[model samples]
Target: MKLLPVFIFSFLLNALAVKGQGADTLKRPIAVQLNVGTQGIGAAVNYGVYEKLALRLGVNAIPIKANDVFKISGFNSTSHVSADFYNIHLLADYTPFKQQPWFRLVGGFAYFLKANGNVRIIPSDDYKYGDLTLTEDQIGYVDLNVDWKGLAPYLGLGFLKTFPKRKFNINLDLGTYYLNKPEADIIGTGILTGNSSQTEQFQSNIKNYRWLPILQLNFNYKF
Candidate 1:
């Protein structure tokens, strides 16, 4: 029995060691970068920690809203507008297709800051139809779990190039997030003599299974 344990350990170690890095592989650049992208562009810092893997951390905003969803039927019109969200992500990317120019894939996880969320339903109507409105003041923080919901998945693809002369690399990444369409309650009022029923339960359209592409023009300092 004792010998079996030792043999198993040895076998596992040998399997890991069998993967070899050829001379050209060793020369590949290791890098660190600061990047910005859409959905409230932000700065992210990442460093190559493995043969073709990078660890990253970043923060982005979730400013979401509908162009127009309200038109007071007859005498008044109602519009439902959403506030925004702050999302922070931590992820790892494997540049398996790094050497290629046309393709690259990156996937990871994110932490959404929901406690600092603000949901306001603004009704833009005439003073006569003026009613109550809601802001961060009312439903300041959601009554549900914000931390667990923060955990999300991330995916990205892009074109990459390494400039030997400049000694740095540049790439453009297009990515999106997979979020569990958050279901939260929003209570607000428009400071008017009337109220709108449209903005009442209009939280369903925040976003559903959608890819909000973010184009990142990033610079990487290779070592």
Candidate 2:
């Protein structure tokens, strides 16, 4: 009767208070971010899940190459090196200190779509085989390729707020990723055929190359 209406009114007031409290705890519900770092240029979307927790989905890529950078003793050659790294990741950001929301703990996983490094060395000097000079095609190149394309775990710290009180903010992330075991191969043409035999040794030497360090800057826009 009359009591029921009063009870409903009270419940509605309580619900409104709870909703207001939640809205105060979080500044923004969604954000878009741009990243630049050792991992390269990337973009991410962030969603606020709680007062001090957020989740982000991001993608990044880096492609680099250099020419004539390596030299073998007693050999005249031109060398080229190149690397392509790309990944898609999901990360959780937790801010422990309510007073210092700028500092956060980050944990996540990334799947490397492409992670490869390669080096190629080609002989530029003419080779004399006995009394005859070999053509450029006769003295080909040696190529070394390494790949670590798989799932990797990431642990890091984030500086600055996950989302700004205003519309835009900047943050820094420092962390490292533990990469999976790698597979390597060596390819050679012409007189470099014997280089393939060194694959096993190279793999052993690089077996411990499983750390990917990250120092990134993120520019965020809250929506």
Candidate 3:
């Protein structure tokens, strides 16, 4: 993690030493980008505010579900897992060196409208209490949920030029968002009711999961 910033800094210094043309000559300052990354698929609009600065507004969303992916030791059970994340963001891209406009310093903020994860576990085996087989509902199940929704600040570096020399270009973004602290809950039914007591412990264990890393590719069209 520490090496990333150092590497970018070194590259920036090298870029500053090169001589190149500026974007001031371009007639079209507006662009649109289609993006995909850890934040899922999204689209953004970009506008150059000055020779060295551009602003972007965009939205992204991710919804995923899986079955039988989570398991417990010494237990025969089926698990369902789901995660959803949605956000709207505004970002600024600033080129510090006139000669190397390809490298940019990016700062932004996102409002996560929905960020939640859920897991449900159910016993998959038949249990007997002295020759009496227990039914599925009698065996019970457990559900664990966590949510991190609200404003998150972003900081990172951008690679390649922000806009195209002609009509199209490709760029990359490397960054991370500092998400708000999450709220967690555990709910259990029937025999697993006692599991709800562990909600506090679960929240404590995940208290530091606020850093959400991002690696995205953007396809840009200058209009």
Alpha carbon deviation, residue 172, candidate 2 (Å): 0.8
- Candidate 1 Cα errors over 4 Å, as ranges: 1-30, 61-83, 98-102, 115-126, 129-149, 162-166, 190-212
Model 3 agreement with the true structure over 90-165: per-residue lDDT tens digits? 8877788779989999877899999888999998888776888988887789999989999888889999998888
Q: Report the CA-based lDDT of candidate 3 relative to the real structure.
A: 0.85
Each candidate: what lDDT? 0.50, 0.85, 0.85
Model 1, span 99-205: residue lDDT tens: 56346556665666742333333334324323644553332321211112555566776566422225576777788766656554444343431333333344445
Candidate 2 per-residue lDDT, tens place, 36-88, comes to 99999999999887766778999999998999777889888899999899999
Which ranges in model 3 have alpha carbons more than 4 Å from their true place? Answer: 1-28
lDDT of 3 at 116: 87
lDDT of 1 at 187: 40
Q: How high a TM-score does candidate 3 get?
A: 0.85
Q: Could you tell which candidate, 1 or 3, scores higher by lDDT?
A: 3
| Selected candidate, larger TM-score, 1 vs 3 | 3
Models 1 onward score TM values of 0.57, 0.84, 0.85
Q: After superposition, how far is residue 193 of candidate 1 from its true place, in Å?
A: 10
TM-score head-to-head 2 vs 3, winner: 3
Clash count for candidate 3 is 0
